[model samples]
Target: MAENDSFHHVLRGLGPQVEHRGEVIVIGLGRFGSSLGRTLVDMGHEVLGLDLDEQRVAEHSDSLTHVAEVDTTNVKALRQLGVGDATTVVVCIGADVESSVLTTAAVADLEVPNIWAKAMTEPHGRILARVGAHNVVFPEAEMGSRVAHLVTGGLLEYVALDDDFALVEMVAPDAIVGVPLGESNLRADHRVTIVCVKPSESGFTYADRDTVLDPSDIVVVAGHRSDLERFADR
Candidate 1:
């Protein structure tokens, strides 16, 4: 091609850097998806966000690489918006299973490299999985424990390292009292690592595994969600 032709070709694709940095298309600019888009943009990756609400799109204009108002139920409109070119397409729509299904199927039909769909229920998750979603995120169910913890004041903090991994801090319950860390075998049996132990009583040193668990000792642990839930129960 001639130089002028090449220059014109580049100009034609001038809107966003969808091809560079591995494009990510996030449908539904709701709370979860909006946060995800902002994080990706902050990381210097390209993100294209779509939502049915124009106000939501406008709200994220500063945080996302690109934002457009579109009804994801229309697969053709999704294609026109370049959903097919995305390296990863995430559907973050909640509550409406039909819209979620349509969007999930649209992305899959476009053959996006990865499709991640957020589900509100176990049945929703199974449906997304059946439609070839690379991963199904059950945000409500996954974070349900936090609500209980917050109400009871038993949890000091919650940090999600990833979809399945978490770091939690909680007051040690009566059951773990008098048990040494080494004997508890938290790492061996549950794959949970105790990063720190803060005793309710003063002048307590929790530097080694030989340290015995005391009532009301604040424990910080890193583990999978299930293991953490079980640990919290104990």
Candidate 2:
């Protein structure tokens, strides 16, 4: 796997970086919300988990910095819980579109510095954005797209920088093996740039124009998604 991919996997397994530790309030204790709260707490941040379900609140109480059973859609109830004071708020009521929108609006009304929400669809995401969510996540859709890329790209790992650009790791193609990068003219031919090369038996190294690629070498490239796909096809 690529270094970036490994880094992301580590974050999922443990938590985010601790550099921005602060008070975070996560409303709705569903799987995604609970996971976010737990990860935040594990990263040394103070995470407060809120949910309408008493059982869910109870289940995450020990893992989080704080847990409360509250109606997130109620502005008065949110105010009483000091929701406005949170540095960051994550609304995770994705299953219920109404609740998600209402909760996001309420948090935004509180003037929280950062608000992240989960949406089930594009329209839902747009609604959340219009209501004041700083970031909207579509877990299922994003995962499905990632799986599709993995299955079709024949790549060791892939990370999208944006809709058009991506970083990908793959084995050196037979046509490129034993050839110097300068002579290959990969950038001119495929519109992709080799960022790094990881030898099967050793660590990673920067790819220079004169670097010779071997069949066993794994190369990390960056370029537009279409360009990378074309390059990988070879």
Candidate 3:
């Protein structure tokens, strides 16, 4: 790369040697990037969005703290755009695996402390990890699995803490309705713990052993995925 690499960009000055406390740089202003940048912006964090497409830069310019058109695969371009000073950088290039991997490699070369990359497949995730992406996310796969669980189980909300463990929100089942939770022996009988419960008329409160559940009430349960499924079914 030379001084005149032809990938001109309009970038905001990072100012001095200090990295902003709550700022993030997002590469590839596609759907994921736009959503993430806007979310960060909404959360009161300054987000810089970078992309190769001028249209993408223009479209997200008003939404993020700053938007720029730059070839992120070029390490020099990223450094010149002040990406090296970012505390966190995320590569959200979804379709083009080659560009995604190369961009991740470039960000790694910058030695940014935190690096996150989106991957379309397991192999892509492995490649990103090998190239120094500290966190590799399979968003589509995770979302699909979550939706599948929601569809199959009669759950109001299902959040997977990890591969095997999960937290779920569901209506109080007949098995536990009318029985005091402590005496119900749910933890011993079903292997699920009721963390909290919400009656129809009030907001949620912590569940204790003496808490008696009522029908039509909602409960938050934490347990292994398999146990949660069985408990939810009952």
Query: What C-alpha root-mean-square deviation, in Å, does candidate 1 show against the real structure?
Result: 12.3
TM-scores for every candidate against the unseen true structure:
0.64, 0.81, 0.87
Q: 69-95 in candidate 3: lDDT tens per residue? A: 999999999999899988989899989
Model 3: lDDT to the true structure? 0.86
- lDDT at 14, model 3: 16
| Clashing residue pairs for model 2 | none
The better candidate by TM-score, 2 or 3, is 3
lDDT of each: 0.76, 0.84, 0.86
Candidate number with greatest TM-score: 3
Pairs in steric clash, model 1: none
Q: What is the C-alpha RMSD of each candidate to the true structure, in Å?
A: 12.3, 7.6, 9.2
What is the lDDT, from 0 to 100, of the residue 166 in candidate 3? 93
Q: Model 2 — which ten-residue stretch has the worst lDDT?
A: 10-19
Best by lDDT: 3
The TM-score between candidate 3 and the true structure equals: 0.87
Per-residue lDDT of model 2, residues 1-234, tens digit only? 875554333223222323333688999999999988889888888988999999999999899999999999998899999998777788989889999999999998998877778888877876887788877777887778777887997788888766678889999987678989989988888899899999889999999978998899999999999988888889
